[model samples]
Target: MTLDFSWAGEKGCVSLFPNPEFHLENVPAGAKSVSLTLTQGVREMGGEELPLPRNGILPAGTFRTFAPCNPGVYQWTAQAKSATGEVLSEARKARYYPSDEVAEHKP
Candidate 1:
């Protein structure tokens, strides 16, 4: 698996085309300084964990990945930088395009 993405941690948000599928094994093995965070907002939105990008990375925070949401506009942010906060000081946005899920009728 090849990691195909421009490491834009110094200018803009990591925006993805309304997608909902990814893999971690595809990320670059040489990845060293990258921070990935996934978040969403909903009416009475709560802690949630939606599908993340393929080989996405995150940091330690009070944020929860257990938020349940419907088909709508969601938001995400990723901060990639150095320890000294030099050279690199930027983030990216994830545009999640949720697909249709078929649920079987329960008797």
Candidate 2:
């Protein structure tokens, strides 16, 4: 499923925290549905604006956009659920570099 991956905001650096324990914890033992979400924040990128959506998830394999604004250092997470609407999996974090177009970057 495609995860709503996104950064917290605009910045020079970002950090992630995805339980490096497993990947694609497919439908839990008895789940009938699944979902994903992300929690992020940033320090720089100006405009007091941020990038990526507030939070959400997607199918199994695809590219989705969270928020829309600028590009820079971003922190995000990928989560999944089951059909029963149970948190089948935990959330994970990671640093993302969408592009290099800020006024000035230092990393």
Candidate 3:
């Protein structure tokens, strides 16, 4: 299983908002649903978590686009699970920086 995604037009100089899009590819046959999480740093920023997909669960094989997030380095995760909440497969990516100089970013 594979998950592809991108954060659309996120720039602090222009805007602090992010519009993220997702594309699911080769989902496992045993998977019943998928959940996507985008975390800003280790803790919720500005008193809130990044907005998640409605209900937090998407049907398998869903190709969704257009979600909002804050501009910063983040930890992104996508999980595939069975009906009983058992994880079938999981994908993780780290060291995501919205800015080119994210290492020195303050927000």
Candidate 4:
């Protein structure tokens, strides 16, 4: 599976508000479902799951929006599961900055 963010900055800096959109692609075949989650430490900011289409394929450009309530480092994960109980997952870290903070650093 592959994940892409709508926006990113140096060292994975991201805007805190207007949460970024996650685009997923290249999901492996036989994946019956997929889910996404965002977390900071032990707190889960947002998550959702979707069942794949009848062909058990995730369409290209499938996307979701996750809200990150605070300015801090966060871990985002995407997972795919098959009927046979096999799982595939990916995780990435990002640093979120409040809009004001981002504006202040502008050149």
Candidate 5:
């Protein structure tokens, strides 16, 4: 499968903030869900693992994959994992898209 990261930065450069916009293609059979994560070096930013639709076909084109809503230099990973958490296949992309929104306060 192919993964596309949506963040605003020059190609192969570090990007600040989070952009949930992502795209996936050619997901393999027997895959249970797609997990997306953002990281700055060894630190976790945020992530999500979403189950595929009942038809087994994902949404067309681009969609928000996960909400890594923190500001930092982060790289992204998209993986197709089994129900038992075995990674089937994965893709990684660095630095794509931009956003101005931050996570809301919960006080």
Candidate 6:
């Protein structure tokens, strides 16, 4: 699975404000639910779990929004679990900068 960040740049840089919507891709079949977790350093920022559709499939364009409290590198984890106890997970890292920091680096 892959994590899509709505506010991320090409190099995995994110902005501090407006937060970001996280999207999943390549979710496996038979997934009953999915969960998203965000962390910075050793602190967990936020997390949520969403049940899949009645067909046991994730809907197209389904997404979760997470708020970052500070500017730094964040780790994201997405996990999908099936009724049979099968789990699929993916992780990614992104650097977040303050709005002013982003503006200063803009080309």
Top-TM-score candidate index: 6
TM-score of each: 0.33, 0.36, 0.52, 0.54, 0.57, 0.58
Query: In model 2, which runs have C-alpha deviations exceeding 4 angstroms?
Result: 1-27, 42-64, 99-107
lDDT (Cα, tens digit) per residue for candidate 5, span 1-107: 77664444422222443344567777777888888776656666666688844453444323332334444445667789888888999877654224522222111
Q: What is candidate 4's lDDT per residue for 38-64, written digit by digit as tens?
A: 666676766667675554344433543
Candidate 3, residues 12-84, lDDT tens digits: the string is 3333333244555666666666666645655532211222243333332233222224445664466777777
Q: Write the per-residue lDDT of candidate 6 for residues 62-85, one digit (tens) a residue.
A: 543344545555665667778765
What C-alpha lDDT values do all the predictions have?
A: 0.33, 0.33, 0.47, 0.53, 0.57, 0.53
Per-residue lDDT tens digits for candidate 2, residues 1-107, read 23233323333222322211113433335444433332235432221111222233232223333432344344334334444445555444344454522222122
Error of 4 at 64 (Å): 8.9
lDDT at 92, model 3: 50
- RMSD values for the candidates in order, in angstroms, are 13.7, 11.8, 8.0, 8.5, 9.7, 8.1
Per-structure clash totals for the candidates = 18, 18, 0, 0, 5, 0
Instruction: Give the true-structure RMSD of model 1.
Output: 13.7
RMSD to native, candidate 3 = 8.0
Task: State residue 26's C-alpha deviation in candidate 2, in Å.
Answer: 6.2
Q: Write the per-residue lDDT of candidate 1 for residues 1-107, one digit (tens) a residue.
A: 22112212212223322222222333333333444344444332223233233346333232433322444334443333344433233333333324323222111
Candidate 6 regions exceeding 4 Å error are 8-19, 53-67, 98-107
Better of 2 and 5 by TM-score: 5
